[model samples]
Target: MTNKPMVSIVCTSYNHGDYIAEAIDSFLMQKTNFEFEILIYDDASTDQSPRVIKQYENNYPSLIKPIYQTQNQYSKGVRVEMFNHNRASGKYIAVCEGDDYWTDPYKLQKQVDYMERHPACSMTVHAADRVLSDKKKVLSRVRPEERNAIFSVERVIEGGGDLIATNSMVYSKEKVKVLAPFYLNAVVGDYPLVILAALHGTVDYLDENMSAYRVGVKGSWTERELATSLKRINHYHDMEKMFDEINEYTEYRYNSALEKAKLGYRFSLLLEQGRFREAKHGEYRKIYLELGAKKRVLLEMKRYFPNVTESIRKARWKLIH
Candidate 1:
């Protein structure tokens, strides 16, 4: 009787036919003695995704179990589908969506070992490399910023670790069950789960880049609109609204507001670019003013004093680029 931890790998696929096989192959290569079951949920894919799932299930019946849906659940929502599929399992959940793949065969083993040793650790996340679709190879290793390697919530928040990479996280069954209710309505489903896990127990940073996240060129959540101010402003506003719903501390709100302000500053570039309508520009200006009070004193000072803002902006430009 093997006493290894049972790891349930959940792979959710929509239209990622091109990437699904490699996703499954990553799991199939796992060298662990633990009972690992791969649950592949095809979310009513119209592409070759169904065929890919069938192929993998046929090849590795011992490790793979494919769940097929007959109709489009797009209206019912992706989050709902994910929660339902995940709730059925009682073991620890390690997520690697069809678009991403685990690179290290010992990824599960390493995490499980750590969690067992450190009973306080609820979740463990490693770093991941980003790959382009056409290239079919890694474009660049998306290394974690110096901050995430350490385990501090403030550092995590300031260093943008709140955007915890989904592929890198390994969730205990208890955490999975706790998060199932919250996952349903969260616009950005992953954030609340991370926050909830942090509340319950510590989330460890595994420092190594052990996974590959395929960044599709035409995906809905790509960073292509970095050049567009209105888009940036809207994105920040959406994040601000999401943050408001968290019932977290004022410090959280303060940090979130600062982030919103920085985004608004970038968004101001659109006004400079003459891309905004007069009314829209006025609204944008109002947003910056509202965010100004919540941000740092320096930013508020910059609001009242343009010459100082210009000098600081020039210094920032020189330093950053």
Candidate 2:
């Protein structure tokens, strides 16, 4: 079909040596008649990731184009580089990280065809099954409507529902040109990308599960500690600040920050109520401060008053003894 559309698949790889091959294989497995190209940026991985990527590049010279870096760049910076280096002469662009894989052969085709037909659509994302690293287990599945029946800006701010995991997303290049700046302009990239894309027009939601999202790997951004969470919260705050700087009248910034703040308050409440087996509140409060949320401060202090009073009692008992 000479008239068929072309889509560019953009994948970023780090040190995913254990699962890089599968990631590359997923793209090559697409059985679409339409022309498509794969762009893989290997961010100077330390392990066998570059080697694995090269193997695929050599194997599929026509379909896969690999950009193996000589030095390592962190995920935050690497993704912005992905947008800058990406030159897709296609109507649409798709994304899949090195750890994630497409389970369906028609994943790209299905989304591409839908977006092409619907001119008002700026992007499309499908549900994904979350796969844990150990036992290669499927932990849970998420869809957009699961978090929100209506894809409004408020639901997005609340951070609920079927979000576009890197692998499960396909976007229009025209929309990309407009939205990529907004996404890259922020330290927290993914959410802003979706927000800006949603602003352009309606997003096509595919109810079908399309990809597998892998978690619990070393050096993965998802594997954040308290320090990392604090840093990320700071970055997320910077992103929200940028949102306000650009769109001052838009209340989504406050709503998003408030959502993060509410999460902090809830986690602190969990800790205060002695829910130690499950909840962690140390870092959530850091996010609350980062978001500049004043409303939750009183609630947070109230949650910690009992612990503070207990500590004082223990000190007094020690002195008396």
Strongest candidate by lDDT: 2
Instruction: Give the lDDT of residue 50 in candidate 1.
Output: 97
Model 1: lowest-lDDT 10 consecutive positions:
218-227
Tens digits of per-residue lDDT for model 1 on 1-321? 243338888877777787888888898898885777888887788889999899888888766788888875654655643643454453577888787888899999898888888777777888888776646567676555544453554434333423467788887777545553433545555555665566567878887888887765443243344424466566555555545554343335446543644455445555444444441455466654554555535554554675786687667534432
- Local accuracy of candidate 2 as per-residue lDDT tens digits, 101-169: 889999988988888788888878888988776346887886666532335555454562236676777
lDDT of 1 at 101: 87
- lDDT for 259 in candidate 1 is 60
Clashes of each: 0, 3
Backbone clash pairs for candidate 1 read none
Against the correct fold, how does model 1 do in TM-score? Answer: 0.71
